[model samples]
Target: MSLNTIDIVVFIAYVLGLIGVAIYVSREKAGHEKDANDYFLAGNSLPWWAVGASLIAANISAEQIIGMSGSGFKIGLAIASYEWMAAITLMIIGKYCLPIFLEKKIYTMPQFLEQRFDSRVRVTMAVFWLGVYVLVNLTAILWLGALAINTITGVDLMAGMIFLGLFSVAYSLYGGLKAVAFTDIIQVVLLIFGGLFLSYTALDLIGQGNGIVAGFAALTDQAPEKFDMILAKDHPHYIDLPGLSVLVGGMWIMNLSYWGFNQYIIQRTLAAKSLEEGQKGIAFAAFLKLLMPVIVVLPGIAAVILLPELERADQAYPQLMNLMPVGLKGLVFAALVAAIVSSLASMTNSIATIFTMDLYKSDAKPRSEQHYVTVGRIVSFSALVIAMLVAKPLLGQFDQAFQYIQEFTGFFTPGIVVLFISGMFWKKTTANAGLAAAIGSFVLSIVFKYAWPTLPFMDRVGIVFLSCLAIAVVVSLFENKVQDNAVDLDGVSFKTTAGFNVSTVAVIAILIAFYSAWW
Candidate 1:
């Protein structure tokens, strides 16, 4: 819980190194200032590795690292279905979805909606995302991250939040997504290695001086109940996991909305050097997905054996950090901070991208690309400031801010998935139908929540998604009019390279083996 000189040195070094890299990677060429594309989309020139690393860095944060570890402590590996299922979801999106987005040369998800539906749909979704990202996503990341740091190091909560906000801005504000995407490579490396090492330390504690393999055996032996990949109907946490629904139902809806349609997460893929490069990057992310539970989940499971009666499950990771030896404690702490700020930077960048590109550019007078890029930087800073200011007011009262935020977001995920999926694939899908799906998804979700209170959340999501699809279909059928804005896939290729194909097989095979062994 205490950081000695060694830990302080390591942490400071990480901060300086990350900032230097961000500045170096985002430097302007002589006589050429950064344009909108360069700032927002990283000049559309990211290699497969940077794109892949940034996506994972953007997705995994304090919420996943700390909250999921808590879930591991409480619910065992069942909590990891979200991570594991996302692996396949990434592959599916890479194969079928990224092509559509990349081919359109869009800057944000809302832009794609404008192309296929209308400006109204685009504006509506843009406003919705901006609200959620600022009030919910950004706030939760900041609050939870600060809380994690405070727990481990006794730092004041407000100071921790301020440091995170400033650090995120320091490395990312000036350079925009280019800074975020490139610096994220360092963040991802630290988080992955630090997380895996922490898991090893915790497992080794359980092994009582035995090696990692023996530690693994001890975990399965001592806390066998936690290892179940699928929960039973009577399991206390079944409501959260919902047995098979995770595999066949609403979990897919959740993953698609996040991995395929969400702005911040998809922005990485959108920045790829080419369609093929992006798809390859996505495949790489899928492989990384398979390893997340080890980095994020295993430590909490180890806690069941290490500190079995902790007051709260959420304390699993922070308290477990007490076990990290002094020399490496700073390194692991840097890893934790890496995920936090990388996610913070990614969210702020996306918020600015959506506001500046989708809303600001549309309404503001035409100007040079530098003008918009400047606006983006200002917006990014403003969003971070607002989030830091309001984070406590918004999230302070919640015991499980992470879960509450997730549940609140789920109210609309089905509708979003339906609107995008129908608009993209159904040629006759009308604008009115898009509105119907988008709006109906939320209203029906509320009705279902109160009327069928006991329905598993995953099941509710799947049911609402199907209902939205049906409503969209009925509305479109009622109009029975020809449409011209359906997605044009003739120009996009679905073929995968030999490397991608082989990687896909390897990822799936690994997932299958993992679940089967733990099942």
Candidate 2:
């Protein structure tokens, strides 16, 4: 799987060009400097397209490209539910959630909790978010990306990981979210083009008669079992997909957590110039999400026909690159790197935001905006360093990185969702209940995890979500009737634009058509 000179040359050029673009977009006018608002939230001035592009660029990274492709090889198209479901989740957030957050003028998710509940809840979740971003999210992205680079170019895995970490810092640390957001548009274009080509190459160029159509036909005919949209209870992979739960159950919790609440992900939407801009950005991302399976998942399913007997499912994507021709192969590899580095930058940038805004700002005395921005840079760099050191050690052993991410993250998502629901809608919900929901979500999940091991985690998540909500509700009722901090939605309309409505219907129709055909 050696890369040709052209492939190497193209990837290098893309990296350099991306860095230049980031620097250019991030420059402040003379006598103005990068301040906290400017650095962290792009000064609240991103356009819809940039926000949309940044959202996808920050998301469809090494995990989706490499890890989920591995799942496609192992679990088939059933794996695409995560992406498909997310389109719906993004719409829900845009219509119902983003307006509130934007109206509140918040920078981070933890900050929202602070405003809605208390500093106790904010600090509790801030610590949890920082840990997850660094330990799980950052480490997984780096290690899995390094593994893919190793597979394609024979680059040493550790060396590849280090290069990726440094590469992200080179572009994003200086400019913060503005640089990351603007440059992400290019990364996404590459990701989509490269991913689609790789899938096509796997089907058409790898000795299949005719082209991609023929290759796809071969996959469906030869491996009909791989095309199921939902797993059966008796299916070997049922524990992973867990039948209908991928649609009607825990998968929603997962999507809501990632799209609506996660600081690292929602940070892009929070940076929009206005509520309308953010929702439009979300609508744009929803359309892109509908296309993601074609780019990311299909390649793995294609691998089942093209390269069936691999040691690991995760290897399916990188190994498929070995089948591609020279110049195009480099383009695809660059695309892969684009996803990895974009996410790395986005994650580190987010880690800095939460640390600086929720933790540092709350504790430290008032300081110059430049001082906080400097601290943010230092924190971002430190997060990258910490993640690089711990990545392989924490994530090296997992064969299918995507499922590991879902399973581990599942532990806390149900509880977080409960807290948010209570904070926003339930007037009687107390800070104690919010704090209790936070702890109770984890404790109950642990109980379900070990005590009821056979419960499919997707099901487990749904049950735990209900359980946590109940716990929070009961606790809230016992303490008080509607707390003063509950959100006042008097004039806040959840009504969306007609354009957004049309987009939502289109997405829903497409999802319906997709599931029906596959089912």
Candidate 3:
């Protein structure tokens, strides 16, 4: 995949333009180096559009671009459950979850735990999240991004990793979440356009240049099996996707933990100007999520039909990129890079936010807001450096990067979800119960992974979630209830503006139509 002069210019211009936009938007006003609020939560002033765009930008990283595409290549449209399910999850979160989070005025997920449970639960979960964000989330994005860049440009993988790390750190370290969120607007736009361009061109090639409709028709006619949204038990890929469980089982656990509870993801909505603004932004993201498979997943299915002999599934996306002519190739490549860098920036900012707010500020006592912001920058730099060093080695072990991420992250999500749900809704859930559920879920996940190896990971997640919920309930029964510490139940409304309601209904209708067509 060699680049001509036009391609080189387009890619270089796109990179420089992205950096310039991030720097420009994130620039400090005179006499106002960001305080904790400004740096961490964008001064709690993100408009609905920025919130929606940043949410998608942060969520769709190299993981979706490279990894989900790889999964699509290997297992077909079943991989799209992650994206589609997330739409429904985001809707539920916006309606039911965001109002509580806004009313509480919490900055991070760990902070919410502390408010509802205790500092012990908060600190334990905080440390665990820090490790996962730095080690697993950050590393996977860098590793997979570098691999894609290496495939596209023939750059050394290590060099690509360092380049991406430095690029993400350069802007995000100074501007923090404000810069990350605002820059993500452009990132999301490029990612959507670039991804669509790639998918469209690939489909065009399949149609022998007839048109997208003809290409789609040829695609279905030739590779009908690749379009299955549900897999049978005997299917080779069943262990990963597992049919109806995707709709009714552990996939929901994953989506809830991710869209509802994950810090980097939810942090965007947390920055919204008001509860209404946040809800609308989330609803907007839900609409975009429905379109994601066209940009992210369909290309891989197209790849299978177009380039069937590729040795590695991960190579599906980049190999498809090789089919593009000069300028479009660079635009698509820029979109890929945008996806990677934006996610890296989002994760780095999140790692810093969690560390500075949940850990450093808690331990250091009240400092100047500026002081904590500085600490955030330091943590961001340190985490990025560590991720750059660790990413290459970790990714080498996985045959399917996306599944490896899901299965490994699955280990802790069930427990985290149980803790959050119990603490939020159940007044009887004691702090000890929350802590015990957290620890017990991890132990049970380990047992499922090692001792019960034949269990599907999704099923394992469901089992662990149910078992941990039971454990928390039993433990809470043994402890005295503290109703004062429970999440406030007053004035919690699922109501939204008419526009948002109509949009939500439209999204659900579209989803139903899709499943009917695809199933």
Candidate 4:
């Protein structure tokens, strides 16, 4: 792949524009004190639109753009269950989980655990999350983004990683969550527009310059086998996405843990101005979720039809970009960059928030608000450096980086979800039970991975979640039932505005229609 002068100019302009936005947003406003809330939570002032766009921007990274498209090339439309299921998951979390989290006034997910269980559980989980973010999530995003850039522009992979890190840190470290969230609005637009353009072009090329509908028809007619939303037991990739199980089984565990409990994904919702706004924003994000497969997944399906001889599935995305005209290639490249940098900023901000609020503030004595904010910036910068250093080498270990990410993260999700769900609604859940379940879930994950290697990862996750939930229940039965000290939700109204209700209904209706048509 090569870039012309027009492409180079567009790419440079995009980078400069992002830098300008970051500096502008991070500038100190008069009378607005720089404190923990202001820095970490955006002063709890993010309105519905920013929250919704930032949530989508933060969630869709190179993982989706590069990795998921790879999966689409390899496994077809079934892979999109991750995105489609997440729409329902977000609605469920917004309806049931957000009220409790907001009422507790908690800054981090681990902090909520501390309130519901004990300090030991909080610290243990916090450390676990920090490791996953730095070692797995952040590293994966950087590595994949660097791979894409290197493939398209011929830049060295390490140089690409460093450049991305500096660009993300430039604004995020100073402006904090506010800057990250607000700038995400633009990032989301670029990502959507560029992604759509790429998909359209890929389809048009496949369809011999016909419209998208004809291109899509050609795709299905040429590779009819690729359109299945559910897979058969004997299908080559069935282990990854088994039929019926995807609809009713372990996929739910994955979706719930990610959408409801993940720190980076939910942090924007936590920063919303009010519960009503947050719920509405989440509903809007659910609507956007419906369109992701069109942008991210369709191009890969088209790739399978157009570039069938490519050796690697991961090359599907960059190979498609190679076909775009010079100016459009630059625009699409900027979109991919936007996806990578926005996610990097969001993760950096989140890691900083969790460490500063959950660990440092509690472990050390309380200091001035400004002091904590300073520490957050330092943590953000350090985490980025560590991730950049490890990303390339760590990602080299896997043949398919996307599947590797899902399976590795699967090790922790079952336990975390079991802990949160049981602790939230079940008043009898004891701290001892929470601690035991957490430790037991990790052990079970290892046992399943090594001892029963043939078992599907999704099935393993489902089994672990149930086993841990049972253990918690059995242990609680033996111990004295703890009094309910969960966050009081009496003051937080579950009543959503009419717009939110209608939008949510529309999202659900669309999801049902999609599955019905595709399945």
Backbone clashes in model 4, listed as residue pairs = none
Residue-level lDDT tens digits of model 3 in 1-519: 667789999999988887788789887879877899999899999999999999999999988889988998899888998999889889889988898898889899999999888788888999999999999999999999989988989999889999998888876888888889998888898999989989999999999999899999999898888888988898899999888889999999999999999998999999999989998899889989999999888999999889999888888998899889889999999999989999999998899989988888854467888899899989988998898888877888786898999998999998899898888888999888888888888899999889988788998999999999999999999886666888767767767889888887888898888888989
lDDT comparison, 2 vs 4, better candidate:
2
Residue-level error in angstroms, candidate 3, position 133: 0.6
lDDT of each: 0.89, 0.91, 0.89, 0.88
Q: If scored against the real structure, what TM-score would every candidate get?
A: 0.98, 0.99, 0.98, 0.97
Model 1 lDDT per residue over 212-296, tens place: 9999998898899999998999998787789889889899999999999999899999999998889888988898998999998
The parts of candidate 3 lying over 4 Å away from their true place are none
For model 4, how does the per-residue alpha-carbon lDDT over 1-519 read when each residue is reduced to its tens digit? 678889989988998888788779777778766899988889899999999999999989988889999999999999989899888888889989998888888789998999988888889999999999999999999998988888898899899999899989876789999999999988999999999999999888877888888888899999988899988888899989978778888999999998999999899998999998899889889989889998888888889988999777887898899899989899999999899999999999999989988889954466989999999999999999999898878896565688889998888888888889988878788888888888888899999989998888898889999999999989888997655665455655677678877877887888788789889
RMSD of each: 1.2, 1.1, 1.2, 1.4
The parts of candidate 4 lying over 4 Å away from their true place are 489-492
lDDT of 2 by residue, 238-281 (tens): 98899999889999988998999998889999999988999999
Residue-pair clashes per candidate, as listed? Answer: 0, 2, 0, 0
| lDDT, residue 436, candidate 3 | 83
Query: Whose TM-score is higher: candidate 1's or candidate 4's?
Result: 1
